[model samples]
Target: MTYCLALKMNEGMVFASDSRTNAGVDQISSFKKMRTYNNGTDRVIVTLTSGNLSITQSVVNLIEQRANDPDVPNVWNAKSLFDVATLFGECLREVRKETAAYLDQTKVDMGVNFIVGGQVAGEPQRLFLIYSEGNFIEATEETPFFQIGETKYGKPVLDRFMQPETTLVNAIKCALVSLDSTVRSNISVGLPIDLVSVKPNQFEFNSQYHITEDDAYFSHISTSWREGLTTLFDGLPAPDGFESNTQAAVTESAQPLGTPVAQTSTQHSQTLTPASVNASVAPVQPSSTQTEAESSSQDNQSSAPTTSLMHAAQNNQPAQRSPAVAANQQNTK
Candidate 1:
């Protein structure tokens, strides 16, 4: 599992990814998922990858190997960021095709995804998401971010907050928070994040960070965001019908014993409360007008009704008194 994302904002671009990779529960490891290809003068391209490590690595290696080859077009010499994405997409497809025959026999996933972005000397900064099938899409103002691998856990914050006009500083912060959210919710994603920022038309990385567990700023962000959410949640008003339900319970408890109460469909379906359980099993007493023998007979009747009531509660049926009590009442009538 992995989490890699890129934000294409008006201020610039932000790229980030978790380093943790796991083949199995016992086989966890860390590898940098963010890669940079730059000549430091003409072009600076950043690639963030997720999926089968072998496939992603092979795609990257193939790009780097052919980078200096005079016969072929490569990332460095590509005229635009779109061309660069096409090149990456081609490499990804080639790698998967080469290994699918061997890996498919064992049902191994050869799926690989990439977030390719940066600036060529003459072009503005841009971002692209290249799919496993070698097709690609460029990020636009309407949807200015792309995420691959374990994206769901971290996507809410991004969907709610990220924008093309967002500042670079805030964008980086949002990216870190997004990664933190993913890392916390998912066991497969972990610390030591690789982050890079590029300013428009700079043709070079404006800032880069290697954030680890001990990094103070990231620690603060994670802790403060968590605690702030808790505080915000605590301060929120109760949902609709919640207070009414609570008040109903309070009112129900204050009612006199043996008083009839209207039960909602929900209450009827719910498990018995402690008070209800106690009432079901409590001893039944004879009235003052009953004769001594009748009183003694009612005392014996009490035990049978208590047992019957318990079964009635379990089966969600109305409790019934013992047949003996009904017979005695009938005789008195």
Candidate 2:
């Protein structure tokens, strides 16, 4: 498995991916998950892929072959980013068609995902997520980022930090932080990471870097993020009223209020205490109980000549009654 993230920002775009694949415990290996194609001044396209390394490689080979072909409409000839994406989808489909039969014979799964993003002359930068079936979707203003493979563990941070208007540097920083989170939580994704940044209207991409284990910027973010999280966790207040007698109190709190309180277990007696709030054993009949309480309080109000129902209604703690009851009382008055 792998993790790839691409972001389309106002100022530019950012793409990142991890480079790890494993067939089994004994067959773990690293391969670059990012591939970039540049036509000098006309366009620059980056493809980040995950799943089924064979299929991904075949797709990349097909794309390169098409680009090199004089007769084919390749990345260089594509009129817009949309056309480029369609070309990629076509390439993926062709690869699948060519390899599916052999891979099926070998019983190897033919799964692959590609995140293709770049700019072509005369159009804004665009990003596309091409699926195994050759269908694709582009990023939009509302949803400005796309992530492929092992995405869930790293999504929350992006959802919180990424925005269409975010600066390119900050967006790249956020992407690295996101990768840091995923790498810590999952083993399938690891360094070295491929990072690419593309600025708007610039036909070529800038700031492409390989982040290995010893990369200073990445190491600083990873270490500092972990330390910051640790400090934050340490700074959070402990559960309220749990400083002493916590286990006993929690256990007692779990029991029904009307149920007989049993002796605290010796193992937890020192830490356990009864909860201040009692639990309700029976279902609360909101209508009947509230009506009875209201009627008894009304009787008290009637007995006190000075305290009128009107005055009681004016008070902050007016008698608790349902809307139906209040309507009935008003009709009678």
- Score each candidate by Cα lDDT: 0.85, 0.83
Query: Which lDDT tens digits does candidate 2 get at residues 20-117?
Result: 99888788899999998886798889999998998889888888888888788888788887887888788888888887888899888887899999
RMSD of each: 9.5, 17.7
Model 1, span 88-162: residue lDDT tens: 988888888888899999999888899999888887888899999999998888999999999999999999899
TM-score of each: 0.76, 0.73
Deviation of model 1 at 325, angstroms: 21
Clashes of each: 0, 4
TM-score of 1: 0.76
**Candidate maximizing TM-score:** 1
Residue 255 CA error for candidate 1 (Å)? 7.8
Task: Give the residue spans of candidate 2 off by over 4 A.
Answer: 237-239, 242-275, 278-333
In model 1, residue pairs whose N, Cα or C atoms come closer than 3 Å (at least 3 residues apart or on different chains), thus clashing, are none
